[model samples]
Target: MADYPVTQGTHGPIYHICPGLRVNLNDDGNWELMLRTTDKRKRSSFGKGEEAFKKAIKAGELLALKLGLLQVEHDKERLLSEVAAEWLNLNRQRWSGTTHERYSQVVRDYINPKLGFLPLSRINRAKVREALTETAKIRAAKSVELVHATLSGIFNEAIDLGYTNENPSAGLLKKILPPKRKRNLTKPDPFSLKDRDLMLEAAYKHLPGSYPLILETIAFTGMRLGECLAMRREHLDLTNNQYFICESIRRDVIGSPKTGDRLIDLPEYLTKKLGAHITRMREEALAGAAFTDFLFPGIQQNAVRLMLKRACYAAKLRSRSPHDLRHTYASSLLMAHYSPVYVQKQLGHHSISMTCDVYGHWIPGEGKKNLDETLAGQPVSRRPALEVVDKKIPLVAASGTKSGTIY
Candidate 1:
């Protein structure tokens, strides 16, 4: 190795570490790596010696290829999978477990299977279009759309890092004609008061202890089932008929609530019922019942959903998930002419527009006296038992709120 004359920067003097790599011990005493190539100058901090030399060499290779000194190995291949792995790692902390799982599923099952092996440059518009077309033949429209989004995101990250120049998947969605299918949630299917009573009655007979009351509380309060399950003794306020939503349980993991902390007010009837339930739990604990961490401890979202299914069956009503009770609460208020803004706060939605977008259909038509008429009044004729329900729901276009809203 040959010693070179020191070059001066405001930080410190620069010294040669290798052929294309130089090092500067900055005023902060940190080793700064400077890659010397054509016209571009790249500087980064890496700890000293052999590790710095390796990183500098790797960076130097990229700089050389970028500056046209060394030919970029198109024939040797830089697969998109390589860039994708880096992208996922880079943004792993930003995504939740459910989100990470979904993104991983799309990548592993759809995107990687078709485009993983291809060089990033080779994944042109035609190739992407063909791949989407093939996938559309097998998957639903929404699933195919997710595949397209995953490809676009991967390609975007790669382009940002200079791994590839163009995003071939970009703007191809307008042209890709995926399969047409029904959307899973056309609108919120909230239960009527009569149906609520029927289900609660069936819950008393069919479900285990406290579930009947639990269902009513969810319908009355608009708290998410997860939030309800995460309730603790300290979260309750019997005097005010309300509870504080500090945390939520998702996929068996306890974390902060979706919309942060908020107070959920309940009807007086519900407040008394919950208070009585708490008294019962306390009495049970005193009589040798195991102490529980949460008010609704020893239960999971799946078990609640399964129990709700049984109650729906026994009530001779449509099978509604536990989340549907939230819809029931929101719709009940809306039809009663409650303000959407108030409902937004109660539902823990980020904004009024989201509540409106979801529950907009629940807003009563002009001159309607009771909101119950809309969700209720299903024809009394019962279909054959054990018959598959294939009826398609129609999507209602939101026309915004019709009447003046109260604060």
Candidate 2:
């Protein structure tokens, strides 16, 4: 062992124990080992003898190198909330405003409250599942699912940044959480064809101005209220008899459409009506009306919904939501034997399964009729009835008198 110079300090003696390593005796006479390697510096105590202390320092350096902690100069004990904030800031811009707001709110309301203080490395699957289970008590299963997804996204970002090795929230939902209850598909209560006609007629009669046209457009095109409200002049092409759906409005903020852009073919009658509507809008614009770009002009979704409700009442029809008009459109298509794929594309659903899952019951097909026909060809058989009467038969006797009689 090389004899190194020991520098005396106020507490005790400090020795240059090795290259990149030091040993210091504290006021309490305990020995501490300090290690400095590349970009990292860490210190710990090694109890007693000089020989034992040197061995401890060597072992510590080897462990730190193996963990890759020797080259990384970061707080290895950073909390989950710190990493989450970084992740949200980096990724929120890619999402729509509503989606960003929703993620932020979920993180604030559910996740951060439960697991924020835990160190990133310590946030394991069990901790994540426990938090979700607790959240499920007061929030709906859907809300819990959102929380789980958000947490998983955060951990994934942490992994990319080398803050953690694994996403604790991965597969946690399936392992510990019960499946979310299926939505009650019957609740939407889509308007039937008769009800639709009656409501449109009632709207034309009872509602003022363009309210009826708005309802008609939604029913005919199956456009969502936001998309309908957000429509503009450039979106329509009368020559091609098509309308482009590239954007939607929510809370008066225009954004990309939910399922991206699509071109919808319009019926001739609708094309003509829309052309007249556009002409009227142009005239209004020239006459110093509000200089808004929206095709519907100055109408909001809530006002439209209120007018729809009154129209349904006046028409003696069951009350229907504005969304029901969209449902009515899809239902009519399916009832006419339109292919589910066609319906899915027309509705701009991201997947055909979603279209089928929601509207499968309305799609026309053989249904139970086929089963009925299969059973209809079978023959029926009947068995004879039994007859009963009071009767007695006896045989007789050792005397050979064959004397028993039945009557």
Candidate 3:
């Protein structure tokens, strides 16, 4: 028989019974911790002091259980890897394929290998911060945020399952800031009016068949490389003068749009170019040349990039990329005074914020025109007048030369 602690019940001093540091109530109950008062009768007479000791001991037992040194009624300590697996299992079906693949890789590559040694309850905010800060140095800001978010969710799940009472990552928001991401500052070589016309002329001169038409379609439509490459014969509708953007081909795998939307329209010039390319393909097939259903098949994506690079070189222009064609398209549309919301839909952006974030800078260089148009759409009180004053008055004579007189 172990010493029982003198704890006060409602009436008076009650000699409470407990054994060792942890007492198992029979074979089935929450383990009760034991602590004896130094002077049982005296502490009991001093009022609720004995009861306070029992409460403190009970709380201590719960803390011990949470820290994984002791087991609770039914809950067991969980390994970090086990928790991560559970997290993935719960979220796998809810996330998109692209999203699920990325989260899985992050957990496997970063979180598990580094933190797997610790039990879920033992992991603390300091450990989580160290992992995230180190990852920021190696990966992009967006990736760091994603990994942090995933880990946070996992820990939250552990809390819900009673593996731990509190999430280690709960206080992380105040402790960590996402690293500032460096924008891709190098601008793509934008095509001038003359440069674009020259490239069109060269394509017509050198690749008179389908290739020229394909180039024209890409230049005018601003379709993504994968989207343009994925175009099939069945997707075209010359009578409607519209080419639908329904799918994309990535690494030769055909799939629906990343934006999850099925359709966008191509401009009439792009439609005509598609028609011409198709006509050329038919002519080439008749002349002992094989063609594919894919409008731009058989050409590797790298080859497309390389070909575009060479064209830029030939034009004596700075190196450009296939993606620049996309910028060119968006810049042109925005310059034409088309609505950003409309452009967002065409580009399949989930939010107008993304459209503005990526392409908003392009509008500022449009020489105050966009600002004026935007301001016009506002309520009368909000709209400000465009003020213009001549900063300098040139001294010109009748002969159209500078006057001899000076102030």
Question: How well does each candidate superpose onto the true structure, as a TM-score?
Answer: 0.60, 0.59, 0.54
Candidate 2 stretches with Cα past 4 Å from truth are 1-85, 96-102, 108-141, 162-168, 175-177, 180-187, 202-212, 297-320, 351-353, 364-407
Candidate 2: the clashing residue pairs are: none
In angstroms, give how far residue 384 of model 3 lies from its true place.
Answer: 22
lDDT tens per residue, model 2, 292-343: 5677766888999999999999999878888999999988888887888888
Q: How many backbone clashes does candidate 2 have?
A: 0
- Candidate closest to the true structure, highest lDDT: 2
lDDT of candidate 2 at residue 36, scale 0 to 100: 82
| Candidate 3, residue 27: lDDT | 25
Runs with alpha carbons beyond 4 Å of true place in candidate 1: 1-85, 96-98, 101-147, 176-185, 279-290, 366-407
Each candidate: RMSD: 20.1, 14.4, 17.0
**lDDT (CA) per prediction:** 0.75, 0.77, 0.65
Q: Positional deviation of 124 in candidate 1, in angstroms?
A: 4.6
